[model samples]
Target: MENSTQITIENIQYSLSDIEKDCWSRLVNGAVKSRSPFHTPAVATFGQKEISLRTVVLRKTIPETREIRFHTDVRSRKWAELLSNPAISALFYDASTRIQLRLNGLASLHQHNDITNDAWQKTTLSSRRCYLTLHSPSSFSDIPTSGLTEDIEQENLSFEESEIGLKNFGIVSIHVQSIDWLWLHHAGHRRAFFDYTDGKYQWMIP
Candidate 1:
């Protein structure tokens, strides 16, 4: 499908140049306020010969640092891929708003560090279950399931029980280098590019 480049919310309209900062504000707000699947953006990383893409829940967005963060199991292939090559791109599209954000960034992994510890402290035990899986993510299995052991299938677990999984939990922080924003409208499309590395922000033809 074709893309659009405009922002129309309520009765107000905003041009790229006038709303660059506002666009980021809205993006961060959407990540926090919206519960839609679009909140889980698809992040792509380079493999040896191809690009690997996987959907990840947005954990945090820091506009001050131009960074985005997500959690993952250290054993996941994407973790290994990022360790090998930190270059990555994340794509987010809000169907209701018809806005798409393409973020290019460098990914850094945090494990067994203060950064991961702080994030872990804020993580709920329910969200920590996936890290308790008996097998590493994507491991070959004859059955189709979440890979969690039968004993750990319960929704709630004691703090001690959840501690085991903490060892595998890791945080990935993406330092955004650039953002390409596109908004679609029946009247016309609006597109803009923001390059943080070079301190550039400008509109472009869709």
Candidate 2:
């Protein structure tokens, strides 16, 4: 019989296969559109042993170039760790379809670039306000203060006063090297791995 042509939750069964190299190519190239409500990238950072997970907005993806981008605060612990060890992993889960993908890549910080600047500009005021805080990421305080302080300095303000807080904006770009996909079904489970370096995709025991 011919394979299912539709690419929805119901047709996902037919699309099951190795985490195709082309999938990685599309992800890296920002070709495959995101159907999940999470238009951003979800990343998992490894600590000494524990794991830190958070939603990271996808900044850019260049499949042919093998580059993926996300952003965060420079003062964050994740930023410090990525600097020491570029290797990182990001997980994308689509609960509606029971699909979870683990992506492995090397992450690099972009401190200066049009892309970073553009992303900073696009940031909403509520989000940009995050950069105005005096405390560093994970810093502790005796009392609770709003995430943003009202006393932003005039000299530090940007041309668009609204963007003044974005001075601390930091962008991270992850260059994917491999990907693994896991699918859970009522009858059985499927798992696959893809290696970009080798251009191969193979099924694996779940």
TM-score of each: 0.89, 0.76
For model 1, residues 11-73, the per-residue Cα lDDT tens digits are: 676655556776567657646765854568999998778999999988888888888888999
lDDT of each: 0.83, 0.68
Q: Which stretches of candidate 1 lie over 4 Å from their true place?
A: 1-10, 34-38
Candidate 1's error at 165, in angstroms?
Answer: 0.8
| C-alpha lDDT of residue 32 in model 2 | 34
For model 2, the stretches where C-alpha displacement exceeds 4 angstroms are 1-41, 47-51, 150-159
| lDDT (Cα, 0-100) at 27 in candidate 2 | 57
How many residue pairs in model 2 have overlapping backbones?
4
> What's the C-alpha lDDT at position 163 in model 1?
86
The sequence of per-residue lDDT tens digits that candidate 2 reaches over residues 68-147 is 78768888888888887788887776667577778898888876578778888777665676677777778888887654
Q: List the residue pairs that clash in candidate 1.
A: 4-183, 5-183, 5-189, 5-190, 6-183, 6-190
Return the lDDT, model 1, position 111. Answer: 98
